[model samples]
Each structure stands twice: as structure tokens, then as C-alpha cells.
Target: MPPKSNDIEAGQAIKRLPSNAELVPHAGKITMDEPAYFGKGIIKDLKTTVGTHWRQEMTNFNQKTVAVSMLMFITVIAPTLAFGASYSTATESHIGAIETILATAWIGCAYSFIGGMPLCIIGSTGPVLAFTTVLYDMSKNMDIPFYTFYAWVSVWMLIYAFLCSFFDLTRFVRLATRFTDDIFAFLIVSIFVIKAIGDPFGGVDGILFPFDPNHKTHQNQDADYDFLQVALLGVILGFGTTWLIFYLRSFKNSSFFCSDTMRSSIHDFSVTFSVLIWTIVSKVIFKDVEVASLNVPDQFEPTYQCCDDACTMFFPKECPDQAERAGVRSWFADMADTNGKGWVPIAAAGPAVLAFFLLYLDNGITWHLIMHKSNNVHHGEAYNYDLLLSGCFNFVNGLLGLPWLVATTVPCIVHLNSLAEKDKDGNILHVQETRLTMLFSHMCVGFSILALDLLKLLPLPVLNGVFLFMGVSALPGIQFWNRFLLFFQQPSKYPETPYTKYMDKGRIHLFTIIELFFFAMVFVVQNIKAVAVVFPMMTFFCIPARTHLLPRIFEGWELVLLDGDIFEIQEWIDRKTDSVAEYEASLRGDLSEYEDDATQ
Candidate 1:
């Protein structure tokens, strides 16, 4: 007969590899030693990363890759046009839709080919948008050409990026814990959620519900009813798209589905299918109703018209009046168009410092999240090299007066999740890591300039629904979000993870509360324009807070249970059990010796 399960477990030994601290004995402690400088291991790092890069892409040629490419293309386009419009408003048309789309296409294509992580989709972000707006305002106040000043700032930031990379400063990202990462990820998710739902209190300027009183169709006798009709259709399209996507994605697990392969295919192309379904609904069923669509540029030209007679070359029949085109600029920024002040270039470094920190934290944190263990990404990291490349791209963009782009969190997460092969329990088995999706998607964005009218058929609310799905879908993976939901649940019914099993409910709540406090601080600071420039600094403070402050409140073992990964928690438990076993053996030996002495 076989041994009983419990009896066998009692005789089994726990196995674990030596941790970094155990191997080095001084791994996490501060010490004075010869540091790795001048990109000491960057060459070898690149060699390892690049060796498998092309081979990985070649092996990923399948239907899933094509499906993901379509999904990402749609995902990237909405935000590009939306942010481009916002940038034009903020900078008074110095940069606009065409420039943004072009930047997204060119930089995205280049990075997909050579970036350290091809899965990370690079694009413009909210913080970079805010920083550029502030820089433009400063240039205006100081009586300098905004583009020229922006160029100098970009140059200084480029210098700073190379210097930091050469000195291996990106190694500091290892100090960031899940505490910091979750907060930032939650903040981004919140933005997407809010934008997708639109204003509930009857706002006309919402992304999906752009109800203008002066629109051409609104001048009819039944304007009020027409507004209501449009609003109702917008709601249907937006929420309907979201519902269809969720239902189709969940169909894979349903018993009534056609076949396993058929259901999986439906799940794989859920987003694309949802978009198509709703778009057809909008176009065919409500053909006469007016709804908001994408605002694509009619031609691939600079958004800001020329200020001088050069306008006649491009638009001889309908050139703008001289007075209307006074401060307009061309595609290339004039470096010498400054206020004739020699100190301007040096002064530009001030804003460049803020830009550097913003890019460093934003890029580093997003990369950290991508390379996170939960994502199951096998590609090695190249933080320093990626940072250097971003700086170079920004320098070129500044020269051409285009918006600076970074590793946008939402799109990166969406891209990663789309390519991930998950089990029935929703665990990531493997990510279809490849370059083809981003390359093909971005190439389509570049080609979109020719088919602007075709793109106009995609209603804004359908895209908003996609945004809502992306944001809501990301929430399940976040531990913080899971814990926050526990605030309303009974303690007895809580899910039995290592933390919930070993740690007290009160202690878990306390740790979550502290994280919430920091998250609130970052969120508040990010929203306020006056303090937004220090947003990166605010996030950076989380590293020190997690490292220095939390250790005082909780015991080391408890922290491992609460904040550590699965392997970490297991190792801690194994170490404690080993120590207890050794103590028992020592006590037994002492007992035997004492018995011998007594007998003698």
C-alpha cells in the first residue's frame, strides 16, 4: 500500500536556491566599492538581448500575431489623435495631429525593431504633454521662440540621459517595490476609466458625447430631440461595445460555445470583433444620426500654416491672411530664433531637469512593470540602453517640433495581455513575445495618413468602449485593487493567499491604507498643474518610503507575507522551518548527553 499523504509530507524536505543576500552577504546594504561606470556591461547586455530578438519575431508568425496587431493598431490610434488635439490646444497649434501621428509611426517603428523590449509600445503620455505645455508657456513669457527653446531643452536632456546611462544610474530602479508600481499603474488605469465614461452631468465636450448646439444638423426645428437621439446612440455604442467584448472574451469558458478552438479564436479577436460589430451597427441602423468620429488630418502637412509668402506655395488659392499667420512656424524649428539672449540655452536646462526626471521615472517604472515576474516575460532587461535611445529620439523630435513620446502604460499592458497565453484559471503561461505586432501596427498608423476618410467611419464612442475595457481588464491583476475590494468584504470570506493566510486582517488593512495615502498624494499632485512638474519626484519618494519607513511598522516576516512575491514568501517560510528543525535536533542531543551523564 502507498504511504498516506500527510505521513509522506512529514518526511519531505523543503528546497530553495540561495538568495542574493545569502550569496553575497552584503547585496542590499550600502557599501563603498568600485562602481560599474561608463556602461560597463551594456555591450554584453545588448549582445544577449539582440541575439534572440529576431529569432523570437520569426517564430511568432501566426494568426494570433495578426489579431494582436489589429487590436493594438486601434488601441494606439485613438489616444494619438486625442492627445494630439489636446497638444494643439495647449501649444496654440505649434504641434498637432499630423506631427503626432508621424512621431508615433516613426518612433514606434524604430523602437519595435531595436528597443530592449519589443513588447513595450511607445507613445505620448499625459505627464509629457503637461510638461510640454508648461515649457511652451514659459517660452512665451520670456519672449523666446518656443520651438527653439524646446530644442535646447531637448539637447540638455539628451546629455543628461547619456550621462546617467553611462554611470549605470538605472540600476536604482531595482529599489522600486510593488508598492510604487501598483500606485502608478492604478493612477493610469483611473485616467482611462474616467475618460471612457464621459461626464454624467450633461457636458458637451466629452470625448464620446460631443453635443454642440451650433452643429450643422442641430439647426433644424427638432434640435432638442436630435441631441437626445445622438446621446442615446452614443451610450448604446459605447456601453454596447464594452459588453460585446466582455461577453465574447468570456465565451472561451462557457459550456455552450461551439468548440474549444472556435471559442478560443473568438476570445483572441474579441476586441476587433467588437469594434466591427458596433461600427456596423452605427453605420447601418442609424445611418442618418450624426455622431462624433475621429478627427484625422486631411493631408500630411504641418498643422501650423506658414507665416510668410511661403504659404502661397502650398495653398495659393486660399492662403491665410498675414495677420492670422503672424506667429506660425514651419516643420523644422529655428534654433537661432531665440530672443537674441546668449543665456537662453543655459536657462533651458532648468526645464530639461524636470523633463529628465519625468522620463526617467515614467520609462523606468513602465519597463519595470513589463519585466515584472507576473507578466512572464523572458526577455532580459536593458534599462540604460533604452533610456539612451529615448533621449536620442526626443532630441530629433524637438528639432522637428514634434511631441515627445514615452512608454505609455495602458498600451503596453494591453499589448502584453493580448499576446499572453493564459490557462483556464487566468494565469499567464507564456507571452507571445515578438516584434511583429508593434511593427505592423505602427506601420498601419503611418499608412493611415492616406486613408483618413476611411478612419472617420469609426465612431468615437466605440473607441471609448475599448478604453473602458482596457482599464477594467487591468484591474484584476493589481493586488492593490484586490485588497481594496476586501475593505467591503467579510474577513472570514477573504481569499486565502499567503498574505491573507499568515498576516492579520488589521495589519493587511494598515499596509493598504499607507499605500493609499501615497497613491492619493501622487494622484493629487499629478492632476494639479502647479505641482505636476514634480510628479516624478513624488513617485520616486515611494522607493525610500517602502525601503526605510515600512520596516519600522511591520516585522520582516510579516512584510514578506504582505509585499513579497510567491517565491519570496515560500523562501521565508522554508528558512524559518529549517531554523526550527535545527533547534529541535540540538535539544535532542543535549537530552541524550544529560541522560548519559546522569546514568554514569
Candidate 2:
């Protein structure tokens, strides 16, 4: 491919080469540019085709595999912290930590890879945790071991998720829209706000129904005063520590100031390290301050020790001498050790059937929208096969004691589109050429959960703060409505429009009215707990409008090119049909009338 030595010296290498005139050979041959040669490339692609296909298959398989590790970490860590803190106000259980971490990691693995919109990192959620705590309380009273109840709940959740997946339940999610997502996001954010923010300001007093208000502690002091003081101190510490950490992290990377990486690293370290220092300092200061610290046991062990630190407490090994072994016997019955005394197996037919239908509708809706937004994975809006696989994944998650898992999020599509090169016209120049950053981000999350210790050190309040920040950030995406309103208002910018040109001069009227109403309703519903109880659950209604109605309606409008206002409906009729045909028929009737008049 290199230029001939003569051409190199001549400095005219770019000129087209001329063919040599040969007397003895059939020399009517064409020459091609050296740069145009693609023979080797074609062969190379062919050689790697099978390998490429196999790797893609493997990556998908690993989604579920990696999820297990993530699930284990949460299952062990979250519950241990929650339970140990709750049970003995002063004591912490290391056993609960290990169990929670493992269970959560297992569930996360299934959720991350297999479910509809497989982007939501599912593990131990707050509601589920609350549910578990209730079960634990009930089990203790009934002489049933807590883990047995947890196992039962897990079984139920798995069954629920599986059934949901079976019926392609995610389809219901398609009904939601951006507005709906926003509302749901708002609701979730409100719950966090109420717990973390509102609880400090007399909000907890409203819910104190069955409490022993005047109960004296074992120390002959009012428990309420101690509880209140400790709660207040905790609230202050949690919020202050969370804020400091966030600010530190925010300042770590300075793009504008050109700060050095060393400085950034120090900032990052200080945030977490300072929080750790404060936690220790707070404990030392409060040694006699009556506030709780971490309740971990003296030693950590890996054995499946059920009673003390385990995910759920188990049966007492021994009973008192004369007290008829009711507790022990009941524990056995709770574990279903005897002839079906402990376990009441429900027919999978009743609840399982209900769960399956719910999951199918839910999964179908979420997946379809995810695919559309992601752009890279267009299974099409009407795809049945993709729905089938999604259902199958959820069904499997249920069997593994996971909460009903569904499609992961579709943010990867946005990441893929970001990397895709664009032409002058902004169309994608090529496909599958860039790394899917968000999907890879999901992988990173899975890996972190697997690593265990990395995430464990981060304070829960900081995480909650981050969640709050993200929820706030999502608010701006809704501002596009303002832009749409601006466009609608400027009809002169768009010359041809029946509604805009004639009906209204300013879209400000409609846009402001609609947006204000939506905002008021959303804010009121989210803030007032009592109103939420009274209203129809709005989240489900929000989903489909986001996914299905808007897209389909837009498609319909584009297909028909409908151009008419309320006043111009009759004008849209065909002129030929109305004028020529109808005119002829009218003429015949007029002639008959005229002939009768002439005869008269």
C-alpha cells in the first residue's frame, strides 16, 4: 500500500495511477485504492462473530449471578443494624448483621439481572423491614422463633414476586407517565422527609396510641423524657453528620478550580473518617448521656447461630424445670417440626394466581417504557417475547425468597445514546459502539454490595441524604412543560396551526392552569398523610399515562395528520364528494320540481 519509490520522490502520490500498456498480456484490468482494501477486515469479523455472541450471552447470565452477592450483603447488614438497635436499646447483635447481608445480597442478584426494568437495586426496603419487625414481635409473643416467621414471609414474598412475573404483570406500569413517575418520586421523598425531618417536631406524638405514656424506667426515671432527649440528640447528630459528609464529597472534585487529586482524596477521606470520629466522640460524650451506640456483640462469628445475632431469633434450647415445655413445644410447632403443627401451607392456587396477574401487568408496563427510553434495546412496544422472559425472571426471584422482583430500570439506554456518535443532523452514526455507562453503573452497585465493607462504613443518614438530593434533582426534568407552553404561546413562530392561530393567543393560560393544579394536588397528597389514606392510590394511575397513552396518542395524531379545530370540523370534508356528487343529486330534484311546475 505504500507509494512506489518513484511516486514518493515525484510528490504527486495523490494523483490517480495509470495502467501500464502490456503487449503480451490481457491488460484491460481495473485498479483500486490501497486504502479501500477491506478483505482482511471481513475475515477478521467472521472469525470473532461466535466469540462476540458468546460473550454477550455470558454478560447477561452474570447479571443474575452477581445479584446473589449483592443480596447477601444487604440481607446480613441492614437487618442486624435494625434489629440489634431495636431489641436491646443498649445491645447490638453481630449475628443479625451477617444474616441480613446474605439475604439482601441474594435478592439483589435476582432483581438486578432478571426483572422488568432490571435497574432498580432491590434489597431490604424500609417497608419490608418494618414488616419483618412486626413479624418478629408477633413470633416472640406466640412462642415462635423469629427466623421461622421471616422464612415464612420470605416464602410469601417470593411466591408473590413469582406470580407477578408469571402473568407479565409489569404491563400495568405502562399506564404511568413522566407526571406519574414524578408524583411517585414525590411520595417516596415525602416518606423520607416525614421520618427524618418531621418526626423531630412533635409528629411522633400523633401516633402514640397504645403506649404507656407515664411508664417509669427500671432506673425510676420517666422513660419518655429519656426517649425524647435521646431521639433529639440522634436527630441532630444524624442530620449534621449527613450534611458535613455531603459537603465534603461535593468539594472533593473541583473542575472549575483545577484542584489536585490529592486534595480531592483528602476531602473524600475526611467526610467518612470525620463521621467515624464523631460517632466515637458522641459515644464517649454520651457514655452517661443515655443515648444508644452501635449494639454489636463482642465477637463476630460465621456460624449459623440462630438465637442471638441471626437474621431472626430461633427457639430456646432449654425450658424451665416445672413449667410444662410449652415454649419449646410451641417453637417446634412454629418451625413445623411436628406433623404440620407449625406450618400452614396455603394452596398456591389462590394467592399465587392473584400475584401472577399483578406482576405480569406491572412488568409488561415497566419493561415497554424502559425499552423505549433506553433506545438501544427496542424490543418494540408490542413485544410479547420480551414480556415472557421478564415474567420468567420474576418467577425465579420469588422462588429464591426475594420480594417480587420485576424489570430493572432502562437508564442504560440513555447511557448508550450518550456514547453514540452523531452526525451533523444529530442522527446516530453507528450502533453498539460505546460503553453503556449506566448499565455498567448497575454492575458497579452490585460489586460494591458484594464487597460488603465498603458500603457498610457509610452512615445510613448520608445515604438517605443522597437519596433526598437525587429526588430533588429529578424535579427539574418536569420543567420541559414550560418550554412546551412557550412554544404553544408563540403561534407566529409556527405559521400553520388551526387551534393556536385562532383559539388562543397565549398558551400561558392553559399551561399555568394545568401545571398549578397538578402541583397543588401532588404537594397536598404527598404532605398530608390523612389525605393519602382517603385518596385512590395515585401511583398506579400515573404509570400507564407515562408509558402507553402519550406515545400511542402521538402516534395516532401523526398517522392521521389531523388538522381541524372545533369550529372547522365541517370544512375538513372532501370538496369533490360534497360539491360535485351532492350538486348533481340536488339538480335532479330541482328539475323534477320545475317540470311539475311547468305542467301546472
Candidate 3:
């Protein structure tokens, strides 16, 4: 009930009491002034998932396990093969396919079974790999042993991650709106696309990074193929792999040659199926042609230190036992050398701080992308928990002389889409979230060396094809690219999004221009050796630019339509349509009056 005016007046003399609509505080405090887990919010996580019924999540899990596992295997293998090789070159660390595959299995399975967000797949990623290269160069220049300096850096990184989790700093990730995420997504997707087909679709293999001398030697010398032929063949096989995967994945919507069960299996195994076909073509037709092969170890062996990138772990570049070496190996790196220098451990804090931010931002942003409501992530987010786990994982890897792991973006999405049961309009009905897919897929990777020679039979171009397909596949989800398309499109035939309805053309284009600026800057920084170590941090500038700068030009309504969350965008749409209808009606009324007056 409302307080009477006289009653309010009377109360004003003594105290003003809140009315019915207002929430009144009691005399005594009922809860803590600050939440105990404000920074380490695990209970909030439970509310996101455990609050929802568990039985239904389990039901979806049972229905899709076998199919999802197959999909996971394909997605895991492609990136593991591509990224592992790249990481080796960047860091000068021989974390070859076997090491990369094993790390993926260990981290993926652990995260799947224990992680708060089941959708995320943990592995090595491009940004971290690039950043590690900077450290490797620094260690060599400073006369510090690479592994010892790296261990100290990893320890510092772990400390930073722990502090972030404790302080609840992961919540800041919410500030990275569509403006930043779209740029990062498109940047990565662009890498995959350009790598498959050369920038012009006719140039040599060097899309952005040039070819290394140690790169696979050509096997097509007998065929007398020139530069153009090899480049063209790479383009052909790459696109072929990409298209084949897409064709099989799209079978779910086909009118024929498709049943629900068949569609499920096809979607799950499409990537692996496409890769196998292309591998045979490279081996039989090309006859072991100069295409890149995964540099697997000759036998089961752990890595050891060496000056050369290609040196096997057990032997250094000039080992005394180089010729008469036994097959024994050591997995853990020796940190005792640094234990005496002591300054190396302390100095590590400087680089560690930079590495910390790189890991934190990259890992957190990827989490937000996978868990975005649009993705229909039913499980709760464990941002704090996962950050801590990732730190621990990397710290252990440091001890083991293994490469650090982080959340990989493309593989995670592939895993989710493979298991997601969608409706006719293509929105997720529910994800078949389970550990089995990740666990089983990783197990396959751990034992991959069992088929060592056969595994090396797969050509690198096929992986490039997977890369191209992933980039093309991701384009549909990015609004920045969609808005950019409107520039070349007819206004009358423009696709309907919240912005197309409420925001003006000039405003939307300006929004896209800002995103492009950030994307371009990050790309430049990533390719430039001097500043590339801070590439992920450079992307953070987009957030403040969106919050403070862009609003100066666009109104609240326009901004919401252009880059707001789902509910805000929908609200703007409804309000704008009503305003448009009112204006049209008033204009009609005036036109009719003018017509009558002229007739009179």
C-alpha cells in the first residue's frame, strides 16, 4: 500500500520511510557486507548449472557420447598437428606432435571431467606460442639456459593467475563486448583462411609468415613441378579438405542420403573422413610429394635440450655420444643451474608479468566466447576456478619440460557444435555435454604414436584445408563481418539484424570501422617481432574505446542495436518500430488534409 500524503508529511518530520515499491532494509544486517566468495565465486557457478536439473544434462550425454567422441578426435588432431609444429618453430622447443597430442589429452580430459565449463578444450594456442618465442630469444641473448628461465617465468605466471582468481579479476572479462570479440575471432579465422589459399590464391605458401629453410623438402622433383604447381596443389588440397568436411556436416539438413543416426555420425566424423581421403591422395597420387608431414619422433622419446631446432631430445648438437647413443631419455628439465644464479629466478618476474596478462586475457576471453548466452552454454562458468587450474597445469608442464597449455578456441567450438542437438532454425536445443567425448578423443591422441609411420602419412595441406574450413565456418557467427557485408549489399535486401532495423547505415559502418582498426592493429603487432609479445594486451584497448569513445557519437538506442546484449537489442527493436509506426501515421494524416484542401 502507498503511504498517505499526510502520513508521509508526518514521517518526514521524524524519518522518511520507503513506500511499497521500494525495498526497505531491516535494522540488523542479514548477510555479509561483501560476499565471501566475491572473487572466488564457486557458488554462483553452481547456480548456473547445478541449479538446473542434472538428469537432463545426463540424458543428452548418453544420447550423443559415441558421435561426439568421433568429432572431438577429428578436431583435436587437425589443430594438434598444425599448432604443435608451429609452436616448435616459435619457441625453439621440440614439443612435437606426440608431446602436443599427449598434452591435449591430459589437459582436455582433466578439464572435461573437472572443469566448471565443460565446453572448453584446453591446449596450446597461437598467441601464447608467439609470445613464448619472444622469451626463447631473450633467454638465449641473456646467456640464461632456456628451460631454467622458462621455469621461473612459468612460476611467476602461475602466481599471477592465482592472484587473479583470488581477487575475482576474471569478472572484468564481461567488459569485452562484441566489439573486441568479433575482432579476435575474425583475426584468427582470417589466419586459417589465408593460410589455406595464399593471400591472392595464386602466390607461394607464404601467406603472412615466410617459409623456413628446414621446412619439408619437396618429393615431387621427379614430377618437375615448379613453384606455381606446388602452390596450386596446396590450394587445391586445402580447399578440398575444407569443402568435404562442410559437405558431410551439412547432411543433417539434406532431404535424402540422411537419417537422424546417419546425420549424427556424419557430423561427428566428417573432419577425420575428409582428412583421410586427402592423405591418401598426397601419398599415392603425389607419391610422398614435398608436402609437410607431422614431425613425429622415430620412437617413443622425451625431449632434451639442444642448439638446433630439429635435434632429438637425448642428444645435443655436439654430444660426445652422438654416434653411439643409447635410447634413454629424461622428461624433466634441470633447474639447478638457475638455482645458483638465483638472479635468473628473480629477473623472471618481469617477463612473467607480461606472460601472465597474455594467458589471463586470452584464456578469459575464450571462456566468455564459449559460454556466451548465444552459445547456449547451460553449465555454470568457473572463470576463477579454471584460471587456477590452468596455472597449475602450466606450472607442472614447466617442471616436466613440456609446453604450457591454454584454452584453444577453434577446437572447443568444433567439439560443442558436433554434440549440440539443434532445431530447424539452427539454435541449440541443448548441448550433449559429457566428459566421454573429450576423454576418449584425448586417449586416441595419447596412443597415436602406436601408428607412428602411418600417422606421418597425412600431408600438411589437408590440415590447411581444415584451417580454411574453420575460418569460413566461423564467419556466419561474427556480426562485424555481417555488418561489413551490408556496405556492398543493397539496403532494401539487407539481412535483418537488430542493427539493420534500429541503427542508421552511417552509425553501423562507423562501428565496424572501429572493430577493423583493432583487428588490423593486433594483426600488425602479432606479425612484428619486436612488439608481438604484447599482441593480446594490445587488443584490450578496444574495450575502453567501446565504452568511452564510441558512445560520444551514437545514442543509447543506436549503440544498443549496434553492440548491446541480446535483451537490450530486442528492447531497442520494439521501441524503434513503435516510433516509426507513429511517425508514418502522423505523416498520413497531414497528407490527407493537404489533399482535401487542394481539392476544395
- The regions of model 3 sitting more than 4 angstroms off are 1-39, 46-59, 62-64, 90-95, 198-216, 219-233, 283-292, 305-316, 326-329, 421-429, 575-600
| Model 1 misplaced regions, further than 4 Å | 1-35, 199-225, 310-329, 576-600
Clashing pairs for predicted structure model 1, backbone only: none
lDDT of 1 at 391: 93
lDDT of 2: 0.36
Q: Could you estimate the TM-score for every candidate?
A: 0.86, 0.46, 0.81
Best by lDDT: 1
Instruction: Show pairs that collide, candidate 3.
Output: 219-290, 304-313
Candidate 1 lDDT by residue in tens digits, 267-374: 889999999999999999998877778777777878776555433222211454434553335778777767688898899999899898888988999888777776
lDDT of 2 by residue, 227-288 (tens): 55554455555556546655654554445435566554544354344456546545566544
Give lDDT: candidate 1, residue 512.
Answer: 94
Best candidate according to TM-score: 1
Q: How many backbone clashes does candidate 1 have?
A: 0
Instruction: Give the poorly placed runs of model 2, Cα more than 4 Å off.
Output: 1-99, 110-118, 126-169, 198-236, 245-348, 353-538, 543-600
